[model samples]
Target: MARVLYDLYGRDEQLRFSPYCWRVRMALAHKGLDVEVKPWRFQQKDAIAFANTDKVPVLCDGDQVVADSFAIMRYLDDAYPETPAVLGSGVSYQRALLFCHFVDRQISPALFRIVALDLLAAIHPDDRDYFRATREARFGCTLEEFHSPEQGQALLYKALAPVREVLRTSPFLDGETPSGADYLLFGSVMWANIVSRQAPVIEEPLVGDWFKRLCAAHNGLGDQALTVRDLGDEQSA
Candidate 1:
């Protein structure tokens, strides 16, 4: 039996809106691979001893330990070549890889601000006041200075332009079917909507249409909570 652990609750000291974990989950779903999902509590790294890399979203299949979302996704693709996780390795693949790198360097960091803001509100209400005071002195303004609505809009544009353009031309980012790029962008956009309540990127008609389509596809998964035992029990010996 194999188990996949994801940080479902970004509630406590966890990194919310994890792009990496989202990629792995989507890959599993797309490939029709059943994985046991273990949702971890914040500050429970010791419990994930098999994670070796000390990270969330590790997939343990028998004795094999899979870490790093991209690596895991690639491994799945190779292991299940019949379904093929990645699309063609032509221009589409190149573009997808380019966007993946851009997302890691550009969008992911900016999006972290949204998570940090949410954490401040949840974990340290008192520190919020102190942070504002000190942050102003240090950064020339408060947290709002760097994370203004105007800046958020710009961040959304820069982060989503590649995806929006792709969606405008094609049904999916890579091709007719969703690929790694779709998962990456979906996770980022979903995070924005959940934490910041803003998805300026998806407001565009083309991108918005694509989002609706994916939502429709995933509507059947429901909000069911899965445990390790369930996955292990169902796994073949």
Candidate 2:
């Protein structure tokens, strides 16, 4: 059995939903790769040292160690091309890159903002004021400036607009079935949901509905998701 060592716990544990990791998870599942998930605490860096990387979501199978999630997904696609993780052929690869590149340029920053606000909210109430002050100083922007709800929504909408367009034409982002683009959109939306409770403001409700559908389709992994440090008594065990 392959062993998947993940940063099950960390300050930014929510990074698990990162487009990078989400793609890997989808790829692995699509390939029917049986894996043993080893949840690692943020402090247990030593535990994953043998995996040859300090990052979580490291995959070890037999004698191979796959570090980065992107690498892992590509490896899975090439090694098990039967199921085909990517959509289309050579030209389709370029199209998939377009989606990934668009996501990197647009959706990711909004996610960062939402995440920062959520982290600030997690601070002690008494310490929140001080924390915001420090954050403002560090970012050269006041809490009020950083916490613009409208701005956050705008960013999210801008990012999601492209995905909506793709979904409008095709059931999935790329075509009939879930493609690399689908995984990217799923990861971004999942990150938005986990990191921030609010929905993005947009004219099209199709995006939100699609997100709901995708969440429902993948709900089994919801509980298994090691986003937060609470794995139901990880500390006790």
Candidate 3:
């Protein structure tokens, strides 16, 4: 079976930085699976039409085609039962799913607003118009008008309050060990980290430390991402 994952990329094809795709990437790593990660862009819906979805993070595992991050993770667990469970069983999976929902509903919005313009700047040239149009239509304002660093930061911190409390006491979301919940949160924070000049998660020491640890997991997988902050650090170095 040819294991392939269509991951979203930015202006630089090497910069595969989609939150949903990151979730899948870490899930694959957690399961000790090897895959060919293909760089996909916002305007490349036709490329994934075979999967019946216009989104990246589409996993093609031989005969199986799975779309959506959560579904893909479920597929991973089911298809490779011998591997470590990505979503655990019933109750545990529900808990992880809740975290996924919280990140999508609360954290992702703030992160998006925080990096709205920066994200625009980083998108592939062919995707710029599509990104700007869809985003502006959703928010009813231009990216320039929607960009709210202060408010986004405030909202992000507020949404992360419970998460901070958890991290203060436990090393990971699943307590001692990172779980599906960890990947979901990490993916969202990574979206901001890679696209924005600043990583808001760094302001919260406990959560930031947890994030750092997870980045170093699966062989420094997340840490290897080409973050905006990394570029600045490189230039300064």
Considering every candidate listed, which one attains the maximal lDDT? 3
On TM-score, who's better, 2 or 3? Answer: 3
Q: For each candidate, what TM-score against the reference?
A: 0.72, 0.72, 0.94
For model 2, residues 70-157, the per-residue Cα lDDT tens digits are 5676666766678766533587767767777777778766665656675454333444676677668876987656766567667877
What TM-score, to 2 decimals, does candidate 1 have? 0.72
Looking at model 3, how many pairs of residues clash? Answer: 0
Q: Write the per-residue lDDT of candidate 3 for residues 1-237, one digit (tens) a residue.
A: 799999998777777779999999999999999999998888778999999999888999988999999999988988888998878879988888888899999999988878888888777768899998998999899999999988888998899999988887899987887878899988888887888775654577888889899999999998888876554432243
Ranking by lDDT: 3, 2, 1
The local lDDT score (0 to 100) that residue 196 gets in candidate 1 is 46
- The candidate 3 region of ten consecutive residues with least summed lDDT is 228-237
The candidate maximizing TM-score is: 3
Q: After superposition, how far is residue 86 of candidate 2 from its true place, in Å?
A: 3.5
Point out the higher-scoring one by lDDT: 1 or 3: 3
* Model 3 alpha-carbon drift over 4 Å, by segment: 229-237
